[model samples]
Target: MTEVFDAIVMYQRDHKEKDLMVKMLTRQAGKRMFYVRYGKSKRYQFAAEMQPLSMSTFEGVINTTGLSFINDVKATRPTSFLMTDIVLNAYMTYIMGLIDAAFVDNQPITKWYDLVAEAVTKMEKGLDPQGIANYFEVQLLPVFGIQPTWGQCVICGRRDLPLDFSEKLNGTLCQQHWDTDPYRMHIDNRAVRILSKLAEIDLHLLGSLNLQDKTKQEMARLMDKLYDDQVGIHLRAKSFIQQLTGWQNRMINRQSSAKEDES
Candidate 1:
């Protein structure tokens, strides 16, 4: 029986000597692997449609075990920007990796499918991709079996005081209780506030990031620490983003030095 569904191309890799294995997060099913064959000329026929983060429709027989097979592929949405924009591609890659890590195969992923779709749409509409990525991370924490309290202190339940993240407590620790956990993450309050906002904000209503460099750095650091301590999943896609950030910083420094030399 053939089925039709829309999905985001998470990634594809070599399946065999002559075939490719494509993974997609489908609206009808969770993460699925499809076996794609090389064309007559010994080239991948659906290369463009299989690009990571591209929205495509798959006509195939979905299987309960092993790899499903795709009979036809169609572009369900425009993804040229996602394919061409390196920065967006990097962020989306990390986001997709997180989603893949959060759920198991063959699980019903209707909500997750909607979330990924909205995140892509938000990025497409010029929302801050980093912020959207952060939002996805915060929401996925629960799927990773970590439910951090964002509204108030995990210990005292007070929301008025400045807070810091605590992996031991699995949530925020108010300043009043800082001594309770010696290893509490001493991040900027602004960054902590941003995390709380991301945890609660709707993806549909998410707005401009408008975050300063220092705040963004602090937020990213805190998130990396928490995920490392709690989730313990490290992704190469995330490492690639880190490398990209380093390159961007170096490029900015070089341009700044060039301007100083001209002056």
Candidate 2:
């Protein structure tokens, strides 16, 4: 049967000469794949939206067994910020990869679809990329049956300000609990507060907040380990983003040094 759905392109891969398989997260349906008649080339009108984090409307046909083929697609939204800014692009990649890792094929995760669409839209509108990403990361937990308890220590139920996080406990610990394990991910009250705020803040208001670099760094470190240790799933997108950012930073540094020498 022919079907039309609102979807965001999450992943894409090229097959032989003129065929590309595209994966999408539909708003009302589960994850789905559709085949583009022509390869993802410059000539393809919908080529730009075939990349990760692009939102589009999909028109296709599904067979009896639920496999679908794409007839046509039109871009609904452009994640222009992600493509224009390297750091933002990396963040978008991480978001896409994280979702891909978290969900199973053909599983309806409309919540995630909405979450990504909103985040990317905000990012496109000049919202802080890291802030947008952190917000999504915290929200992603519950969809996968992993809601974090941040206000109190998950281990002993201590209500005092948390000092560190325990992967075993899947949350933070008080000072007393933290000191015993030297290898625990050390966290200050600020980090915890950031996490709390990130979890609760509305996407539309994300642009209003000014996040400190320290808090962003801390959250990045904490959440990376949390996802790996607690969820046992390491998102490759994080590493890719880090590498891209690192390389981009080095280029900027080198350019600055050359400019200084010229001066």
Winning candidate number (TM-score):
1
Give the per-residue lDDT digits (tens) of candidate 1, residues 16-93: 677778888989889998877772124666677777788888788889889888788755688788888998998998
Cα lDDT of model 2 overall? 0.74
Off by over 4 Å in 1: 39-45, 257-263
**Model 2: which ten-residue window has the lowest total lDDT?**
62-71
Name the top lDDT candidate: 1
- lDDT minimum window of 10 residues, candidate 1: 38-47
- What C-alpha lDDT values do all the predictions have? 0.85, 0.74
Give the per-residue lDDT of model 2 (tens digit) for 12-106: 88878887988777876767776776855669877776777677787777443555676677546666666778788778878877788778877
* TM agreement with the true structure for every prediction: 0.91, 0.81
With a 3 Å backbone cut-off (N, CA, C), the pairs that clash in candidate 1 are none
In model 2, what are the clashing residue pairs, if there are any?
30-108
Which residue runs does candidate 2 get wrong by more than 4 Å?
A: 41-43, 62-66, 142-147, 155-162, 180-182, 200-207, 245-263
